[model samples]
Target: MNVGSTSTGTDALAVLTRVSAGYGRNVPVVSGVDWALRRGEAWGVIGANGSGKTTLIRTLMGLLKPSEGECRVHRNIRFGYVKQRDGLHDLFPFTVREMVDMGRMRGRRLPSDRDDRMGQALETTGLVGIADMPVRELSGGQKQRVLIARALVSRPDVLVLDEPTNDMDVAGEQAILGLITRIRAETGCAVLMVSHLLHAVLQISEQLLIVHEGTVHTHARDEAVHKDLLSSRYGIPVTIRPGSGGGLSVEAIPGGGGGV
Candidate 1:
């Protein structure tokens, strides 16, 4: 994968304008944020609790209407979304395969082709062996992978995830992160993920969007800038050290860069 170059089709994607949104009749949770998601770009949105991270994702999904600015997804664009919470209820009796197959049904009428796509998605997410497993029976990580597979089965041009690694162990987190990198390498689909895991986000994200006080404070791909902003925002003293292969390592400074 050419990490230095943006995806070839990036120019074809839509530009999100100065979008603002909030709950009904309440104050806006996000405002005056203008950003664009290019095809095959991987972006991470980081912020503290109540920082409107999930709200931003919801607005992108068209589940919430923007109260201020326009959000324009390009024509013919196809997208898949994974929410922080499992929207699927536990009482719903669906197997992993069945749930994944539903993704393909969203935009097509051909059942056979949909099934084929579902199979491919399962393979992509490494859930092929557990195709017959019940959704509720899978572990948290497995279930999250299934959700990702469900999103991929539709063959989206972009994938959006909110707090995808929220309730998982270290191994689970690593597995999901690996899957994300592999998927991007294989499919070249754009990814927009909202996560609080600063270290993990820094590892894979090509760009970072920092939201604070209902607005975007910074947007950049530089590792040093991201670490500095995160350290300041979270009150964690952060120091950047050079790593192997020209990467950077971030360490928290004792009793510094830490405060709310």
Candidate 2:
């Protein structure tokens, strides 16, 4: 759960102490997860599809009641959530600007009609030119950018992104990742990214968290990920190598290649 934290002093934005979360009255999907996310840090969470990554994220975001222990965020802290692109309805009627305006709803102190923030978000996300366009007609990358804009409009202290580059082409994916990197540098906001893009995640994340079963394994930026552990958990031969972009790249041995 630790994002861009360094050995030196930095304030924590959120902390989870022996936490567990799941649907009401059901077995917990994730348990005993203890971690802290510090301000101005970037953390990447990776795991198999059903390994409770999403559930853990929901717990951290306070969208789900923790079945055990505690999940705490700093007082008055704001969060920005960017869901997977597939979650956006293609036929939704809202225009891009109007859609981005919806982000202001979560800010209790913000004026009800904070159009300025919406406008700034569009500009920041490079959607100003198309702000008036129908959301359904936008390209996949454009749609994802709109979602990012919505999240940014609130000036959140922490940004949570789930598969932000999903359904995008290579160019689109690179563009979005680059945008996120730039945003993190500019705003100094803690970023929590959950994705299957191991290379991309490693490139920008200061810390890596790998979830297996109901537990978590944390690694610092310089620590190596255990290939055998990943292979065992995923039932495939996972390997890591240096990427062209100066970060470690992860791949599965052929019999079928996929990330957990």
Candidate 3:
């Protein structure tokens, strides 16, 4: 892999140059990646289970260190991260407002603008009425929204979501996806999201990244390259076609199962 240089983009919010990440000093789970996330852009990452998608995001978030190369964020840039809701402690006694308020920790003090941002985040996620409700009382979908609201409280320049809609049903998935769109539209926040919802990813992303065997394949959303790359990476006869709603859809070819 090329594992491009460390030269930053003119307006990039973050840049990854020849970056590699893993649990310890062992063989890296993801390596040789070169990417840049520009302001107001949305990038979607997809890969099969164990392909290191979460590792890559965590590395970007500074939650994990890269074993080699650089993962650089714009100086002083704020990042908001929303992980899968499954990781939330349902038994936590915090109310919705208190939970979202945690996002303010990144700042020195609760400035007026930051306070307004937190209130707006809760209102934007439709959690205002339930602001005092215990997080344990919320449904799965509601909890996911609360998580998103918490992330938004920082008014971060870059937002990263790892499998935000993992366990939701179709309606829940659509709602979350729609909420993501609204967030980007309103805040113009650069978004890096890892999702299993192929069609929704296709609809929202400006760029698509497919991770396979710890490597990365990137393509513009409108590019045709993904069809072959995805099929080869997944070891399946994957097909990409237009859906009735003018979005792309991916499916495995029937009876064409065993891959090349």
lDDT of each: 0.75, 0.80, 0.81
Model 3 reaches what TM-score against the true structure? 0.89
Q: Positional deviation of 145 in candidate 1, in angstroms?
A: 0.9
lDDT tens digits by residue: candidate 3, 27-120: 9999998887888999999877788899888888777888888887766677889988888887668999888888877646664577787789
Name the weakest run of 10 consecutive residues (lDDT summed) in model 2: 1-10
On residues 39-132, what C-alpha lDDT tens digit does candidate 1 reach at each position?
7888888877788988887777677788888766666677888765466557876899888877876544644676678878999888999999
Sort the candidates on TM-score, descending order: 3, 2, 1
lDDT of 2 at 53: 82
Clash count, candidate 3: 0
Model 3 misses residue 212 by how many Å? 0.8
TM-score (C-alpha) between model 2 and the true structure: 0.88
Off by over 4 Å in 2: 1-10, 232-235, 241-248, 255-260
- lDDT at 144 for candidate 1? 90
Candidate 2 per-residue lDDT over residues 91-206, each given as its tens digit: 66889988888888763566555877787788889999999999999899999999999999888899999988776766787889899998899888999999866777776798
Which of the predicted structures, 1 or 2, would earn the higher TM-score when compared with the native? Answer: 2
| TM-scores for all predictions | 0.84, 0.88, 0.89
Pull out the clashing pairs in model 3: none
Better of 2 and 3 by lDDT: 3
Model 1 residue runs over 4 Å out of place are 1-12, 85-87, 107-112, 223-227, 235-260
